[model samples]
Target chain A: MFRLEVRSSTPTWFNFALPLLAIGATLILCSGLIALAGAGVLEAYGVMFTASLGDSYAITETMVRATPMIFTGLAVAVAFRAKFWNIGAEGQLLAGAVASCFVGAIPMPGPLAMVLMAVAGAAAGAAVALVPATLRVKFKVDDVVSSLLLNSVIYYALMALIEGPWKDSFSGYPISPPIEDSANFPVLLEGTRLHLGVVAALIAAPLIWFLIVRTTLGFRIRVTGENPEAARYGGIHVERVLISTALLSGALAGLAGVSEVGGVHFQVMSDISPGYGYSGIVVAMLARLNPLGVVPAAIFLAAVMTGAEAMSRATGVPAFLSDVIQGTALLAMLVALLFTAYRIRRVGVAR
Target chain B: MSAVFEQIFQVGFLAAIIRIATPLAFATLGEMFSERAGVLNLGIEGIMLLSAMTGFTAASLSGSLWLGVLAAVLTGMLMGALHALFTVVLGLSQHVCGIGVTLFSSGLAYFLYRLIFGQQSVPPNIKGFQTLPIPILSDIPVLGPAVFNQFALVYMAILAIPVAAFVLYRTPWGLSVRMVGENPRAADSAGVSVIATRFQAVILGGALMGLAGAFLSMAQFNAFTFGVVSGRGWVAIALVVFGRWDPWRSAGAALLFAFVDALQLRMQASGLGHIPYEAFLMLPFIFTIVAMAVMSRNAVAPSALLKPFRREER
Candidate 1:
């Protein structure tokens, strides 16, 4: 019989190979569902791949989709590095969208409006995140439940806005009015939806990576997460680090909403996000909490999301196969992480 | 405000509170059992959604409501086992794994549902549970109709509180669950199986959550809409904290939240105020957060709640 034994160290290739292996395993595992759906697995996956990454237009669409996840993935990666459980990224994202939308609606110079939107969105997100951090630090509240509950509170608030005052009075649709035309994020490519936010998201990843790898705050965050008591002993302000981490993380998530509002929809709505905040957790885990890894992870999920609809139409397989793949990828990645800590040893035959 | 109060004092209002609380109570109790065993099942939201779908499908297809409930409970047990396999057996991070379970289950539910039912303009629904009033209890005036006249699943939830209390506080297995949750190493030294007890507790918890799902789809909504379990599972999680993980208290928390919820519905129905309906929907969540802030100082979570037990670790 084989059993897991703690490993002293792992090889460097494990990092690169593990995620690929997990993704490969996830695809293979989900193939069973495709077969059950009475469709040829290969044909379905082909449809999915071609539909998501095939042409320039499709590629642009996927990039647009990946933008928010990139931001959120960074948010989660940052917070988790400090061992701060922040599940309210969804709420923060909404807060950002609302703030940015409010800013965008005010008639102003295009460049100025854009700048103000990002700042306001990020600030709003940081403010919402502050509540949980402050609660955890001062009131001894568990951040997990409090942060999670905030998502619903924010959601209802958003619904109230759109359904009430923000309602499109003419059509009676519960949608916020479009932002000033000048405030719309300029599309990067002609005839494609690729916006400035995509570029910003791409650049933000490496910048975040740098900050995490090369900064004093990053070191403190890492140390704090690894051992709070040790961090305290080492003269790191543990509680301060937590609050700082929360602000940074929340700001990143807020930018996700800002980009979506500024670059894509240009207005807020009830279904503004299709659970991108939760997807950030999946992306962060698959990245092993590495900010640089978040880009590819976000792209992978984006492709699945973009492709699922096409796959549904082509092979008649349910598009939710993408969702299942996301969950499986996360679980598989978590399992693969086991390799970093332990190895299987066969004790019976060794002697 | 007086009109709203008038709406609240009636037998109908009490009955509404029971209807709303039934599902929340089951879910809260389910989560409480899992947490008591030191496994926080963040998979709850997705589990309830999946269970609702499966239960509705079974009942609609077989023309048997009880069969739907059985299907839901089994679904919960299976998913719970899956969760246990990851967190308990592999000793993975409970937080991320729970989220994964939720995402996975919710995805599977949606995929299978679409494959089986196909997309239609109107969602398919089934004939749901009918309330069976308790004989002597129903004869009593206001409390009777509100508390006694409920579906079988609702009755089960009410009975489940005391039963859960007995099992948790009095039984040997219950002690083992508590032991594992609070101090696994000591329990292991005492020869109690931490792994097994935790698995059983989580599984039992999943079964109860399944009943909650069954209540939603088969009784309350009478259909498996995507929004059928909308945030109730999360609300239940909050209620567990509010109730301090005690069965009776958790059930009481459920009732209290239900009271707030029923009041919101009543106010909206009365159309007496200019307040947006969404404002009312936000109350339960805000209430929970505020309550947590107030009660957090005195409330203590199980020490081993998020910790994974590995005998080899120092």
Candidate 2:
């Protein structure tokens, strides 16, 4: 009943249509899950979409949530494009947050202090990544394991810091002291949580696109990712490029940490991030590791995260359902993307 | 000096380490099977977490720890089957599949925990499994009590080491599994059902993972918390690589992790502790990375570990 179709490569239209198809499938599946959770799919979706976009305040909150995801998604995308799996972005983000916390606690001029803190945050995130990168380059260690283990260390370290030396004595809370006003990112809109981090991320998206498309380094990266032996034959420094890209990727993730601390929370807490690093993987994958595509993907993820609370409060559905949806979407996207590249060929006549 | 020896010689401390190491050892051994079969199951953390929650809930409801353990194992098997369906049958990326599984399971576990337990501040507690000391060995000094005095699950975990080692090395089935991991085409050529073997291994590994989760809830804590599994699954993953896919060696690596864990808890409890507990808490992770860096030089991962094995014609 089905006709055989042959095409040399996937067209641009197919590329755009694939994500749409994945989303359509995701929404239908999620609706079923929502109904299973004892909520009307329409009502649940209404509350979610409305609460996330109905008001200016809601939009700002969505942006605030999305800011770090943008950086993290880009971070993951950069490494993924280079065929390097840096699963340690969560740890690196924490490293940046911890480092910025240290910097923010220091007394200095406001603008200058903020700049220095961002730099330190980036450096700390990159430094934590160095362990995995160095091991991958020197000992051929799998970055996946090293990076994943580093997350546990970072988590414990943050926990220890908040519970001990960095504890907020005045408030009797397990949170770090608030950053100095000078170290805070200026809010972009009055009376809203949106801040300069959004601008930074926006600027970064285009810059990343440019770097990957218009530079000599980009050529090396694409060549290496496509074929390592071929890239080496072409006289590219494969190891150096991989290491530098990894560092750059980690720095972006660290900057996301800075955004959380400087532009949103103004202080580090044990729960500073709600697993944004992990969620970033979905964003990166959904965007197909295209840097420019990461923006909208991140925003969509942020919208889901932001709306989860409302969904929980209104429908009595746990907000974690959003996580399930995000994860399902990622799985669906991966499957769909795979099908796009390869199709199963029947060896025998149809029965 | 004798007092120092006496203090260090307490059977309780050593027994506690063994107890703690049991689940980690089980999970690490399980991961070794999957990794050796050429799939990196990062969903281990999620699998353990979900199984822990399900086992705890089931045990609390049924008032039977054994039933609870069974439920956990079944849940783990379900997750493993799901993973196999996605990664093997559907041919999805293992890493993404793992992350998706983790997210889905974690969310499901958390939601179910809230739905069943309600919004109570204090968590519910249940009767935990008691220790079953070997009668004859209980009377012996040092090694006897240390090895003999443990929960039923602990003994099972200990037995699993040799069983796993035997299956992995001395058996033809083990050779087929290794061949699938190293070269699927060759395995397929030799009449080994690559997909079937991989699916079997993944599910088998998943069952052990579930048992490990059950041990945490039914034996170790007698309570369930959101963070019960913590990062133990990640530690298990590291142990797999560090152990070089050998069950005994992986178990040894697991014991080292337990030592660090036990030492941290002990240091936290000790009044004479010098370092911040955070520093101590970070020790295992830091050491894991450093050790991986050092040992990875000569380490040989399974040739097909993270790569999807597609038939050449595709």
By lDDT, the best candidate is: 1
lDDT (10s digit) by residue, model 2, range A206-286: 898788888987777778778989989989989998888888889989999998998888888988988888888988988
lDDT of 2 at A343: 52
Per-residue lDDT, model 2, residue B192, is 94
What's the lDDT for residue A202 in model 2?
82
Poorest lDDT segment (10 consecutive residues) of candidate 1 chain B: B1-10
Q: DockQ for each candidate? A: 0.83, 0.72
Clashing pairs in 1: none
> In terms of DockQ, which candidate is strongest?
1
Top candidate by TM-score: 1
Q: What residue runs in model 1 are displaced by over 4 Å at the alpha carbon?
A: A346-351
Q: Docking quality tier of candidate 1?
A: high
